[model samples]
Target chain A: MTNPGIRDDDVLKAAEQWRREGRGVAIATVVQTWGSAPRPVGSHLVIDDKQNFLGSVSGGCIEGEVIVNAGEVIESGKPRLLEFGVADETAWRAGLSCGGNIRIYVQRVD
Target chain B: MRLDLLADLNAERAARRGAVVVTDLADGSQRMLRENEAASDALLKSLNVRLRGSKSGVHEHGGKKFFVELHRPPLRIVVTGAVHVSQAMAPMAKLLGYDIVIIDPRDAFATPARFPDVQLIVGWPDNALPSLALDPWTAFAAITHDPKIDNPALKLALDAGCFYVGALGSKKTHARRVEALKQMGVSEAKIASIHAPIGLDIGALSPPEIALAILAEITLYLRKGEEASA
Candidate 1:
């Protein structure tokens, strides 16, 4: 039987492979969530410097911004803790329609 | 983010062994701890507890927060009888993310057409159970009432520490089966572990419903770490 958590593992494995292949990679993980979050706290999204990505951290509500920030993290070799919610000023502009709060921790894996 | 650590973790997963990856949330330093090392590693004591429950979470320890990711082997079910109940149970278990293997010596009954997309072993329990290497992640069901087929398999499953062991029979049949198990020198606690008359008492009248009840019982045991009757 296929392992139910294989997708999560696959994302990590892909990140490692991308790094080994000389492509800068970063991973964004949902470290915390409050009410009505589409994904769980441990959900992940792995992104490469070329904008290729795998997995999801917020279903579809906040990935576009996370992916953009991930590219910056890859280039800077720095980490970021990004928070989004209806309480944030960019919520409506970023289309965080889930009406919940999420904290994403992004870091360069290489 | 260590390649060697990832390689070792992959190897453990490929071998169907459980492990936990603890990632330091501060700097992204990661470490993989295998099942055997969890007992002696002070840093892994709390992680080991989560691993036993098959859970993953973020926790704070020593002023550092870590993300503990659990990687458990796939759940497996071994059915001793290729009877009608096995037909219904195998597919349902598969849908619930269980790897299924059906064993029955009767070639006519244990066929590809009847149990499509499942591992079929046309062999007796004595030989088949050993080859399968039953472990804590596996659940065993003896649906065949025949003593010759069910008795040996139940013994092996209990001895191997399978998480769940169920037998199918009426009250009288179960009593006789218990006596026979005693004759084979099975301990009282081990014999008590068997869920006789198998499945939850859901008032099931047909083979498919009975199969559903059995799967329900197995799921309850797996999730709650205890038996549920109805």
Candidate 2:
């Protein structure tokens, strides 16, 4: 699923604030969703101040993936896309079913 | 953590944290204000009119930025059709965080017994589309195979500027639909907006599969708009 307008607006707001404050902020978005997915496109799930987050990419399957990669995002302060689905069985154990896929894009605000 | 006081003024009461741009002009202003100080004054003026309890931060650019936040409503989806595909679609759309409303003219098709969580509408598309008030934020799907119902509904939705307008049918069926719409004087550009054979070609055949595909397409359209703005 993609991120919604309001959610993206929130993330943008947060990111800009982080930039002003000189603190790194990472924005994660569910850009693509497949069969039986939990969240829609434009679903905003913001991760900052460690793993503290707002929004959801999946039921819970992809949060850890987001969290794990957040550190890199925090360091790089650039956007990245992470994909999870049946193709990645390791991701399935995280919570999603077979055939369901999601593309999460992460960007650092600060 | 600093509170987003400007958000409170925007009537965002849900405590969903967000930020607001403290612009110097109201939404309807046509010309840009020339002076930075003048713009700031205008923004302060507008904020006083539309929002309440707002504190502003002045920036080097002279544009005020306030970190205001409030909860947003759940995404809404309006599905027109009580067909089997819609049966799978309503719940599926909900699972993806959409507040689903199903509109079908057939009383038997729009029964609450069939779709318990759906906001069921047992009215013709002509009446239903207006009452629903499809917004740019709303996603609409017309899955009814009957063009008589789907056409009027589509015309209204397109005119209303719904973000996504998709319909179910094969390419041939969609081409015929285009002809019908053209005869109705809908511009070719407007008629072209319909995502015919609605859904990404994930090779769907079953009702559930078709619903999944349609939802995927909707998701794509929604995301594309978000990313463009970002």
Instruction: Please give the fraction of native interface contacts (Cα pairs under 8 Å between A and B) kept by each candidate.
Output: 0.27, 0.00
Candidate 1: tens digits of C-alpha lDDT, residues A40-88: 7667899999899988887687899999999999889878878899888
Q: TM-score for model 2?
A: 0.53
**Any residue pairs clashing in model 1, and if so which?**
none
Model 2, position B153, has a per-residue lDDT of 85
Please compute DockQ, using alpha carbons, for every candidate against the native two-chain complex: 0.33, 0.04
Clashes of each: 0, 17
- Local error of candidate 2 at A10, Å? 15
Task: Specify the poorest-scoring 10-residue window by lDDT in model 1 chain A.
Answer: A1-10
Candidate 1 TM-score to native: 0.83
Query: Which runs in model 1 stand beyond 4 Å of their true positions?
Result: A1-31, A41-50, A54-63, A76-101, A104-109, B44-48, B226-230
- Candidate of highest lDDT: 1
Alpha-carbon deviation at B62 in model 1, angstroms = 3.4
Query: Can you write out model 1's per-residue Cα lDDT over B1-230, one digit (the tens) per residue?
Result: 55568668767876768787778888877888898875466877754555655556677898998877777777899999899999999878977879899999989999999989889999999988888999988999999878999999999999999989999999899999899999998998899989988998899989999999999988888887642423
